[model samples]
Target: MQYSQKVLDHFMHPHNVGKLENPDAEATEGSPACGDQVSIFMKVDENTHKIQDVKFLSYGCASNIATASIITDMAKGKTIEEAKKITWKEAAEELDGLPPVKMHCSVLAVDTLRKAIKDYEIKHGLAEEDKFSTDKIIEELKKVIYPNVGEDIVSLKMVKYVGFKDGTAIVDVEIPKFDKYRDNVAEEIREHLEKFKEIKDIKITM
Candidate 1:
């Protein structure tokens, strides 16, 4: 497929390439089996709480690697709060535009950034209220039944990410590139979580 010019540039000469030293927060993410993985390291100036340096290591397709490079570049010099606002859309825009099928590369970058921030927050003992519904309900459910495993609808690691807006809830799930079985896992979880009127939107992502 012929990628957009910007995509080609990023793929060919990614920015902010390398790893940071003694970073305040670091996170490794991606599906190793799928051959897409990224590790992000960031250093924050203690007094300012601004990211002073950032780096990444990635093993993936061109878009995935390029997105990681872009995210690290964007995070540098920005406050943690500012960095959190950098969305997948911004990453895609930076790359001009990615093919629809490769769009997940951008989402992966965004999720990795979140995971890194969460790691930093955890390390600092910053226990603020979760922005979204992360009630341990999912944990309890895991014990009772896994999402899509054990030849049962209840045993799989089906849920990927969940977001909320007001009372609307959005859930994202990974569709197995090989199996059709997990396709409806998100819907089932949505149905279960929708029991409360507080949930206004339940999104199934695959």
Candidate 2:
């Protein structure tokens, strides 16, 4: 895959790559088992609700590190509300564009930043924790990118069904039998859903 000069530059010399001491908020997203994870830390100005400083730690490929680095730079001086608006698509575009297969790295980076902002909000009583439900599961599924197209499975109409009963979550997806990313899609689903403590087990059917 040919990466843009911007992507290579960020990957070779990432910005804001480290943990912030005594961060007012922090969050970690993704799973190492799936080969990518990002942790974000932030210091916020209570009065202005602005991110005074931001940093990240990434574990994965060059795309992962580059995405996290760029995300931190984007969030550094933005208010929590402003940072919340940073989407994966915007992050990818900021880097001049990421390959379709590597698009999820931008998702992970933005998700981590948003999670950190949420942490800050909840800690400061600025927001309340959202109750988990089947709807939440579906929302999370939207984060699962189809590597082949760099679009979410939900948006791609690949997700056929979603249900939750008792302690188990069930998902039905439609992927061609020979699709190279079939396993990757399933794993991504599991990683996204597993974070919900309400889910004791997951059943994915293709």
Candidate 3:
């Protein structure tokens, strides 16, 4: 697939590529099975709720790196509310345009940023601890529609296990690495689970 020059530029020299030391808030969002994952760290002003600094670590293709690079630049200096409004479509437009198949890269980037903000909200006592239990998460998974089959994974018995530890959620699926739908399933799971603020990260095992 051909990528825009803007995409190439950011990927080659991805901005804000590192970890923040004892960051005020941090988040990770992605599916390793899909081959793209991004982690975002932010230093937010508690009084004003503005982002003082932002950084990221990306593990994916050029689109993934570029999306992460641009989104960090957009988030810095913005109020937490302003940062929350940043969308995947806006990130893609900032990079000119991404191929339809690669649009999910921006989704991964945006989701990570939003999750980081949620972490800030939780720490500041603006939000409640996630009330959704492990059983609730599994029930939510049953609602996700697989793109091709028009069926939920639960009905197909694709989901094998669901576990939690230290706020991170682990979902095990029985899908071959070479299957085209493998990453799609993982990404769908991530999207479905994003509303759970207590989930620090998602691990999709194939």
Candidate 4:
């Protein structure tokens, strides 16, 4: 697929491409099932709760690289609260707009960024212990409707597993072979998970 010039530029020369040793907080997000993963490392000011530095590592397509790079550029030096408000749509716009199918790449980047911040908050005792919950995520996933099945994915026996840690949820789903509805299902699951502010990342596998 032909990517925009901005996308190509960011992908070719991704910014802040390494991890910090003993960072204040860190997080990883993506579909282990799809093998598209990103890990974010951040350094924060303990007193001010501001992001002092940020970086990322990507293991996916050009969209992944570009989105990750742009997010870091937009996040560095921002206060924790400000960074949390950075949306995937803003990341896509910063990239000059990714292709429709590649929109998920932007989501992955934003999710990782927020999760990293939450990781910092949780570890520093700024967030409550029950801030992140695996059961709540499963309940949220149960609300997702599988487009082709017209039933909740949980009811259709599609959810294989659900795991949660440090504000990221890993969900494994099984869809029959050659099922054209796979993308739609993944997108719907993402939309549902996005509603939960504490949920910083979501990975739906099929």
TM-scores for candidates 1 onward, in order: 0.64, 0.97, 0.68, 0.69
Q: Residue 140 deviation, candidate 2, in Å?
A: 0.7
Clashes of each: 6, 0, 0, 0
Give the total clashing residue pairs for model 2.
Answer: 0
RMSD to truth, every model: 10.2, 0.9, 6.9, 7.7
Q: Which candidate is the best by TM-score?
A: 2
Query: What is the per-residue lDDT of model 3 for residues 37-64, given as tens digits with 9 covering 90 to 100?
Result: 8999999988999999999999899999
- After superposing candidate 2 on the true structure, give the runs of residues whose Cα lies further than 4 Å from its correct spot: none
Q: What is the lDDT of residue 203 in candidate 4?
A: 79
Query: Compared to the true structure, candidate 4 yields what TM-score?
Result: 0.69
Between candidates 1 and 4, the lDDT winner: 4
Candidate 4 per-residue lDDT, tens place, 83-150, comes to: 99998779889988877667767777888898898899889888754455777787666656565533
lDDT of 2: 0.93
Q: For model 2, what is the error of residue 112's alpha carbon versus the real structure, in angstroms, after optimal superposition?
A: 0.6
Point out the higher-scoring one by lDDT: 1 or 3: 3
True-structure lDDT of candidate 1 = 0.67
Better of 2 and 3 by TM-score: 2
Per-residue lDDT of 30 in model 4 = 68
Local accuracy of candidate 2 as per-residue lDDT tens digits, 85-200: 99999999999999999998998999899999999999999999989888999989989999998999999999999999999999999999999999999999999999999999
Error at 123, model 2, angstroms: 0.5
lDDT winner between 3 and 4, please give it: 3
Q: Using TM-score as the measure, what is the rank order of every candidate, best first?
A: 2, 4, 3, 1
Q: Ten residues in a row with the worst lDDT in model 3?
A: 143-152
TM-score of decoy 3: 0.68
- Assess candidate 1 and give its TM-score to the true structure: 0.64
